[model samples]
Target: MNINDIPNKSFKTVYKGIDEMEVREYLKEIKQHIEELEKEKESLQKIIDEKNENLNNFKSVETSISEAIMVAQKAGEETKRSAEKESERIINQARLHSETMINDAMMKSQHIAMQTEEIKKQSKVFRARYKKLIEAQLDLLSTNDWEELLEYDKDINVEAQSKVDNIVNNDDNVNN
Candidate 1:
C-alpha cells in the first residue's frame, strides 16, 4: 500500500474506542526485533575483531617459531630440532587457518558494502524516474488543450443548437 493510505497522526484519534495497547505492544515487538538485530551485528563485529587479532598472533608465533628452528639447526641438537620442526609446522597451519578466516571476513564485509551501494543506486534511479513521471503529468495537465477542452463545452452546445435550427429550416423549405 502507498504511504498516503495510512492516516495522518491527527486522524488516528478516530479509533479511540479500539484498545491502543495492542498497537503499543506491536510497536514494542518491532523495537525488540531491531534491538536483537543490532546485537547480532555487534556480535559479528566482535567475531571479526577476534579473528583479526588471532591472525596477527598466529603470524607472530610463526615468525618466532621459524627463528627458533634456525637456532636449533645451528646448534645441531637432533631432539631440539625435531621439536622445533613440529612447533613450526603447527604454527604454520594455525597461521594458514587464521588467514583464511580473515579473508572470509573481508569478503563478507566487501559483499555487504557492494550490496548497500547497489541498493542506494537503485533508490536514486527510482527517485529520478518518479520525479520525471510526476513532471510529465504536470506538463500534460498544464497544456492549453486541456484548458480549451474545459472552455469548449458551452460553445459546443450553442453550435449544436444552431446546426439543428439550420437543419429544421432546410426541411421546412423542402416541404414548401
Candidate 2:
C-alpha cells in the first residue's frame, strides 16, 4: 500500500521458506526509498508552484504596464486634439501666438512618445530577465543533486534515516 504498510507487511513462512529478517530489511529499504522519493516530489512541486506564481505575477505586471501605456497614449492624443482646437481658435484672433502654441503642443506630443518608448523598453528588459531566471531555476531542478539520495551505499544499516535527516537539514539551511 504505502510506506507504513511496507515494513508492516506480513508474509507467511513455512519451515523452508524465505528469511523473515531479510524480507523486512528489504521492505524497510523500500519504505525509506519511497519516503525519499515523496520528499523530493514535494520539494519539486513547491518549486514549480512558486515559479508558476512568479509567472502569474509577471503577467499581471505586464498587463498593468500595457494598460498604463494605453492610457498614456490616449491622454497624449486627447491633449494634442485639444491643443489643435485651441490653436485654431487663437489663430482666428491672433495668428502670431497660434504658431508658438502649435509648436509647444508638438513638443509635448514628442516628449510623451519618448516616454512611452522608454516604458516599452523597460518592460521588454524585465520580461527577458524574468525568463532567464525561470530557465535557471528549471535547470537547477534538473540537476544531479536530486539523485544523490538514491545512490546510497547498500552496505550501511542505519544510513537511511541519517541521509533523510541530512537532506532535510540541507533543505532547511538553503531555505534560511
Candidate 3:
C-alpha cells in the first residue's frame, strides 16, 4: 500500500497479540520518516526545475549568438563585393579619362605642328621678297644715273630733284 495507507492498516485482536500501543508508536515513526523524505524530494525537484530553466536560457543565448555571427558574416561578404565593384568602376573611369586626355594632347600637338609649318613657310616667303628688294636697290645704285646726277652743275635743278623724288616713290610703292 501507499504511505498514506500505513496509518489506516488494521490488525485483528487475538490472545497474546502484539501490543496496540507499540504498533501505533512504530507507525507514527514511519509516517514521520515518509514526510521528511517527501520534503527532501520536493526540494530536489525545485533544484532540478531551476537547473532546467538555466539550461534553456543558455541554449537560447547560444542560438542568438549563432544568428548574429551569420548576419555579420553575410554583411562582411556583401561589403567586400561592393568594394570590389566600386574599385573596378573607378579604374575603368580613370582609364577612360586618361585616354581622353592623351587624345586631346595629340590633337593639340598636331595643331601646334601645323602652325609651326605655316610660320616656316611665311618666313621663307618673307626672306625671298626681302632678297629681291635688296637686289633691285643694288641694281639702281650701280646705274650711271646716280653718277650723272653727281656730275650735274652745283645749282641743283628743281625739275631733276622732283623727277628723282618721283622715281624713289615709285620704287618704294613697287617694293611694298
Candidate 4:
C-alpha cells in the first residue's frame, strides 16, 4: 500500500478495537494535538507579522535612498549650470575688455597721427621763416648804401621791439 493509505488502515484498526476508555483517551490526545497546532499557527502568524514589518522598513529605506539620489542629481545639475554661467560671464567680460582695449588703441593712434601732422606743419612754417630771415640778412650784407642799410636796420629793430612788447602784454592779460 502507498504511504497515504497507511493512515486509513491505522484509523480502521483503532476504530474496530475501540473500547470506551481507549476511545476517550484517543479523543483527549487528539484534542491536545489540535490545541498545540493552533498555538503553533498563532506563533507562525506572529513571525509573519515581524517579517512584514522588516520588509516595510526596508521599503522605507529604499524610498529615502531614491529621494536622496534625486536631490543630489538636481544639485549637480544646478552646479553645472552655475559653472556654465560663470564661464559665460568670464568670456563676455574678456570680450568687453578686448573691445575696450581696441577702441582705446585706435583713439591713441589717431591722436598720435594728428600730433604728427601738426608738428610737420609747424616745422614747414619754421623752415620758411628761417629761409626768409637768411635771404633778408644776405641782401642787407650785399647792399652798398650804408646809411640806407642803417635806417633799414633801425626800422627792423623797432618792429622787433614792438612784437616783443605785444607778446609780453598778451601774456600778462592771459595770466590775469
Could you arrange the candidates by TM-score from highest to lowest? 3, 4, 2, 1
My TM-score estimates for the predictions, one after another, are 0.34, 0.47, 0.65, 0.55
lDDT of 1 at 118: 100
User: After superposition, which runs of candidate 2 have C-alpha atoms over 4 Å from their true positions?
Assistant: 14-16, 95-176
Model 3 Cα lDDT, one tens digit per residue, 79-141: 999999999999999999999999999999999999999999999999999999999999989
Question: Which ten residues in a row are the worst by lDDT in model 4?
Answer: 2-11
Question: What does the lDDT come to for candidate 2?
Answer: 0.90
Which candidate, 1 or 3, has the higher lDDT?
3
List runs of model 4 lying over 4 Å from the truth: 1-48, 145-176
Candidate 2, residues 107-174, lDDT tens digits: the string is 99999999999999999999999999999999988988656645644425357778889999999999
Of the two candidates 2 and 4, the one with more favorable lDDT, higher being better, is 2
Shift of residue 1 alpha carbon in model 2, Å: 2.7
- Highest-lDDT candidate: 3
Q: Name the lDDT value of residue 153 in candidate 4.
A: 99
For each of the candidates, give the backbone clash count. Answer: 0, 0, 0, 0
Model 2 residue 160 distance off true place after TM-score fit, in angstroms? 99
lDDT (0-100) at residue 110 of candidate 3?
A: 100
lDDT of 1: 0.84
RMSD of 1: 55.4
lDDT of each: 0.84, 0.90, 0.92, 0.86
Kindly provide the TM-score of model 2 when superposed on the true structure, using C-alpha atoms: 0.47
